[model samples]
Target: MYRANEPIDGGQNQNAATVPGVVARPRAIRDHLTPILDDLNPGIVAPEIQAAHFELKPVMFNMLNSIGQFGGSPHEDARQHIHAFLEVCDSFRQQGAHEDVLKLKLFPYSLRD
Candidate 1:
């Protein structure tokens, strides 16, 4: 389960390899995922979220599960969906698993930069 309330400070246990403040924006971790986080209702894989939205992770969906609108919620944003899909593709590529990016949604180029 997603331990959102846990004090995310495992590095200070005195037996860890790294120290505090080494990770750089620990709360901004985009892929902080865990299985069976029951409170999230319909939790999703962390990688499904886009890196750009990492800072807004906590309040992004207002505590809803299944991404911003994967289940057809009214809060759906096309831009967010596109970004999430692209991020997933990037993650797959980083893992040496390539996916053919034939043609995806069209958005303003500036949004990427």
Candidate 2:
């Protein structure tokens, strides 16, 4: 049986010099793989998203808040609340703000705890 620390070929194990028990990848292979591994990493943000410009105006928040919080109230009309919200969103959309920014960021602020 061969031990992990013991050289298999008369003290000529190729990896023994670099690491006691671990093998080191060749420099060429490591260099070639680095860029591919970086691209595959999810934490890296795309250039487009990083360059995107999203401006949030206080008036937009006021408009959404004016529509009132829809907290599943039995007395409140959910459809009417939704219609008002969409109407406010449309007004902002016509004014050059992205719909996704309005929905994702400001919509949460419109909700009540």
Candidate 3:
């Protein structure tokens, strides 16, 4: 099931050679995704919702994050990208939920940033 309480690691490449915070970490991404999953779960269920959402959350988040990056500019684009991404993700997520309910399968999400 899509539990809202799973510990989020942000999917950082743990094996990468890095000192620490210097790396472009996924902390923000994780933070962003947690609430999304929590918000989404009122409508989804799987034997492994926690694992599945964990696997898919970043993809959707990153995609939305990218759109904002493009829409915003030297002035400030993150907001644009984030907004676009979330809009798209929210629509797709609802669709995926409906599909999952019908097929009894997991919804696959992708982040193309």
Candidate 4:
């Protein structure tokens, strides 16, 4: 058990030594992390990438509905229905449709009530 102010080894505080040409400064956590954080998360995306992303359009609901619907009927072959749906999705993808937008927006329209 050692006292807080008492020197630990040979009457010297081993942790209190200062290095040559080095100055200790008080700083916030944000200050130390700002450079790393900035590198990891640049706030703004490049304009060309943004433009390319914005240009991708999802297939319209009406178009997807017109293509086909799967009602989960016992007579319906699930594999065939899934294959057909994926085929259509693939065609749309080839035409620059965003995959997420197509799946989220158009998939529901291909479901029969």
Candidate 5:
């Protein structure tokens, strides 16, 4: 369609948007947190201060194992996985493409390949 003084309608007259190069999206835990802890080391600087040293990792072993063990408690594992998965999705939605959030909901676990 065209007006008296207007040009004829042509959908091909428009230019397409330029897309940027393939980008590596920032991962919250891997990119940000790991850099901070990359050079970190655990050591006691004060031996005379009478400070209590407890290994938190080994201490939580029983509780952590009880969550995912077969016939132990499947509910806890599901909750933890759901929470972790949603946290990653939320992080992506905040910084990365929101469309990627849809893919986050689909974790590939159905095949060994």
Candidate 6:
């Protein structure tokens, strides 16, 4: 009943669904990741990309919750919002906005560890 862009925890009708958010939870994502991963752009494959992508889900959820409540920075609560924003940018690539994709691809790294 929810579109991918719509906030899952937004204050419409909380009781209507036990599950919430852009992507579903661990169980559902785990079960479906293989096929979905197969279909996705291959560059997404980092060592812990899936976990990095979804494990911080509480960040996105909390962002939605906070934004719906009042004026705020959804990002202030969690750095995961950075990744969430990245996901949104990537999604927009299908519509031909490639500079962000290129920038994401070309991010510089520090040699120091």
Which candidate tops lDDT?
Answer: 2
Query: Estimated TM-score per prediction?
Result: 0.23, 0.47, 0.23, 0.39, 0.22, 0.20
RMSD per candidate (Å) reads 18.7, 11.5, 19.2, 11.7, 19.5, 20.4
Model 2 segments more than 4 A misplaced: 1-51, 94-98
Q: Which one wins by lDDT: 1 or 2?
A: 2
Where model 1 places Cα greater than 4 Å from the true spot, the runs are 1-69, 94-98, 101-113
Highest TM-score: which candidate? 2
Runs in model 6 deviating more than 4 A are 1-75, 94-97, 101-113
Ranked by TM-score, top first: 2, 4, 3, 1, 5, 6
RMSD of 3: 19.2
Q: Can you write out model 2's per-residue Cα lDDT over 55-95, one digit (the tens) per residue? A: 77789889988889888778988789778877887787523
Write model 4 residue lDDT over 71-93, tens digit each, in one string.
Answer: 88898887887777676766665
Q: For model 4, what is the alpha-carbon lDDT of residue 97?
A: 42
- Estimate, for each residue in 1-113, the C-alpha lDDT of model 6 and write its tens digit: 65654445565655534534455322556675556455677665333222222222344444444433222355453345445444533433223333344334322210012
- What does the lDDT come to for candidate 2? 0.65
Candidate 4: stretches off by over 4 Å? 1-63, 94-98
The true-versus-predicted C-alpha distance at residue 84 of model 4, in Å, is 0.6
User: What residue pairs clash in candidate 2, if any at all?
Assistant: none
For all candidates in order, the CA lDDT equals 0.37, 0.65, 0.42, 0.58, 0.36, 0.39
Q: How many residue pairs clash in each candidate at the backbone level?
A: 0, 0, 7, 0, 0, 0
| TM-score, candidate number 6 | 0.20
Which pairs of residues clash in candidate 6, taking residues 3 or more apart in a chain or in different chains? none
Per-residue C-alpha lDDT of model 3 across residues 7-102, encoded as one tens digit per residue? 234434455444433444335666866654544555545433332333344555555444543422466655654455446655544322443342
